[model samples]
Target: MQAQAFAPRLIAWQALNGRHDLPWQVNDPYRVWLSEIMLQQTQVSSVLEYYPRFVTRFPDVQQLAAAPQEEVLALWSGLGYYSRARNLHRAARMVVDAFGGRFPETREALETLPGVGRSTAAAIAAFAFNARETILDGNVKRVLTRVFGVEGWPGERNVEKALWTLAESLLPEDAASMPAYTQALMDLGATCCTRVRPACTRCPFAADCVAHQQARTAELPAARPKKVQPTRYATLLLACHGGRVLLERRPPAGVWGGLMSLPELPAGELSEAWLAQLGTGEVLPAWPEFVHVFTHFKLVITPQPVEVDALAPRAADDTRQWLTPEAAIEAGVPTPVRRLLEALSSGTLSVSHQIST
Candidate 1:
């Protein structure tokens, strides 16, 4: 139960059992920072698919900062919680503008960057600078809560504060072991002390874990309280002309922030007005209705495909574009939008009903 004993056991166990080959486990802060941001609210398996492509495209802070936001969002299309991608781009600019294209080496400075929080900052500090700092990320939170039998939801401020205190108390005196110690905590929580069906028998802290001793490993880390998510409606205009479709870039905030998507009609607005605004188009048919659930609400999207004879010329802006269906699919669109566009282009869009408007 002593603070000093925790890190050594974790570090020793990590040497033989921890993940050693993750793409972002290197000593470089840029890679570490990118991985941390991507891993937020996303599983390791999903992050693996995007991490390599992202690094290969951007390479470093300077390149990432210099690249267009659309390109960055395109690379990050499928990964949800898109605000993380936006913040990653914004933070890269901050690092370049303030730190001369170098990632800050200290926890305080790192925390000042967009999307990098306390735990993320500590991780970068420990791995990149070899600084003795503690990280209380989700994995570490689970590990610490179970080992010490901390009772209450980790989201609660008091519980979080206590965990942070415990985390700092358990920091290893030897700075050299920071990386292994940090990674060990993450590995243990993710692979062993999982949220469901934890492998308590193989845990190194089994004998000392208060939750295991009390037969309450499953109940120690309390779950977040659930709330009812309200439903919302949207009408997506799949306006097309010959081989191309109309796509619009969303504002830099809100749902699907900064991503390219099919032009949307305002709530309670008729499809005919929107079609007239764009160009002379005939409203063909309605595609199948689908629902996309966000963290706070459910969106019911009604897809109205309009075949345009001509597109009215408007002042050019970065927010609107007309591209071939294939290119639209390749652009940074939400998953649902991508699916509809793909179906539209391939002549496979299922027609559920005809739209006269």
Candidate 2:
């Protein structure tokens, strides 16, 4: 298909078949920005549940900027990648301070925000401001890769550069079409050109898609090179006292940053030394070990539930709290931690007999 024909065809298709009722489709950049951040590495269905609640809690840039980071993190709980929420909070304050609570209209200026990257900035600009900016998000990457038959993993620097070039080449000449055009690219890739078992016949690009024509749909977007993922082991201390669990705020960086989590004991740490902070407690049977996979490594977590008569006075500090499982679930805990809390609150804690190596 001619580069000139791409935008018009996509825009037409999107007008009729694209998702139109998403809560964030409003022209307000704040809503657009929130949806964009929440949608990162998250499914639309998940965002559908969180986005409305988020907007209802913090309606605008000024409101989000003024809200406490803890509230922001709490609202963002269960949405993995807590850094996005942290950056979002920081970015909201930055926008309030730097731009008088208004989102920058241009993509270049928008990229300067904490969590808003190139594609995010472009989408915000195009959808919110009708700016003619090209977006090369994951969906667009997949679409371009298969339709153009681009070889090599998109994560590779050189391959990404080529995809960006192709993306820029297909931008709608009219700025007015930017929103529809960008959404079309995303919708096409997400709904039709899925990563697995794509609906080739339903795709508008089926006639011109190199992957479909060449029968290489499965292999067109090359997969990432494999590597042996290393596992890190830790014991999560689920110390219980009077029906409340001891939780600590993780440091503001690294895994589960700035979120409340069960106190962790690394593999080589001494139990007696670690217990010095928590005082004496009766150790219960260990829960079944489970693996939480990160992007680069696997975290082998063993939940060690302990029945403590009382916590050390020093244990309850600004960074630590003893909350009922009900309250902890509502706090900013990681997904795995939340699951454990849910099981504990629901009175379904089953001790696993055989621990995985």
Candidate 3:
């Protein structure tokens, strides 16, 4: 097969072979961007349900921009990587303000928007505007690395640069066919050139794949040495009274920030003084420990569920709230907090809760 004919060949192959039923596949930029954001570090099956519900709630940029941050964060709960939701909302506001409520057309301007990084920008530009920009998402990176036998861990700066160059050079055609070609490349990578157990016999590019030719397909995409994820131990104080739970909004900067969660003691341990700071009375025995894991850190929350008489209600600030258990669920607490509440509602506080940990 001639290199010059690769573009048409791939497109032809994809027109017949590509998966077209994805939630974002109908040539809609808004859906594409939304799905892309959610799909980051998340799988497609997971995003399928989230994508439709989110779009229905906030169908367009303007609607998304206007929705309350708490509601938006609530919708995005459980889809770990909360920053993506925050960035999506922030970018929506910017689009409404700067671009007349429409996502930008070109990759250059789209990249300027919040959360619209290079790969996402390229995807929107190509998939939305038919602009001939190349995307280097994880799937494409693996496909390209394996197809061309590029031997380097893509996490390295130099390796990433080389991969981007390879991606740009591999453009299927010009801007006109970019929408189809972009989708084709992504589809091929996702379904056929997968990380493990690729469908080599069914892949159109198998004959041309250097990794396949050398029987090194599985090893073509070199793995970067794993970094030891740190373990963080913290104490969470869960206080409830009269069917209401006490939660504080995380300051809009740290983990789970801008989202209401069960108030915590100091990062290390729960002390009587900390409970006093919460204006609480005598605390009973400590609740069973629960754990929540994030990308960079693992949190061990030693909870102290204090039964209180009442809590003065107010917005998330230095103060806390006395929300009904169900209302607390709607207030965007972290998964662990929700689990703790579940334990309380179920009258099983002694049971340890493990979530994403």
Q: Pick the candidate with the highest lDDT.
A: 2
- TM-score: model 2 vs. ground truth: 0.64
Candidate 1 per-residue lDDT over residues 1-357, each given as its tens digit:
888898898898999989999989999999999998889888999999999999999999999999999999999999998888899999999999998889889999999998899999999999888888899888888989989999999999999999999999999999999999999989999999998889988899999999899998878798886787898888888888878888999988988899999987758244556766776767776777777778788788888888888865644786788888789888878987887777887797683333211
User: How many angstroms is residue 36 displaced in model 1 relative to the true structure, after the best TM-score fit?
Assistant: 0.5
Better of 1 and 3 by TM-score: 1
Give me the displacement of residue 299 in model 2, in angstroms. 22
lDDT of 2 by residue, 222-332 (tens): 999888799899998888888898888999999999999999888824398767677787888888888787888988888888888786674436688889998988887
Off by over 4 Å in 3: 1-3, 226-357
- Stretches off by above 4 angstroms in model 2 are 228-357
lDDT of each: 0.87, 0.88, 0.81
Cα lDDT for residue 55, candidate 2: 91
Candidate of highest TM-score: 2
Off by over 4 Å in 1: 226-357
**What is the number of backbone collisions in each predicted candidate, taken in the order shown?**
0, 0, 0
Give the per-residue lDDT digits (tens) of candidate 3, residues 1-357: 355566787788789999877778867788888887888888888998788899899988889999888999999999998988888888888989988987889889988987789998998888888887898988888888888888889999999999998888778656788888888888888888888989989888788889898889878799987787798787777777777777777788888888888876656566767566556555778876766778887787887877765464465554477787778888778888887777777787585544443
Give the winner by TM-score: 2 or 3. Answer: 2
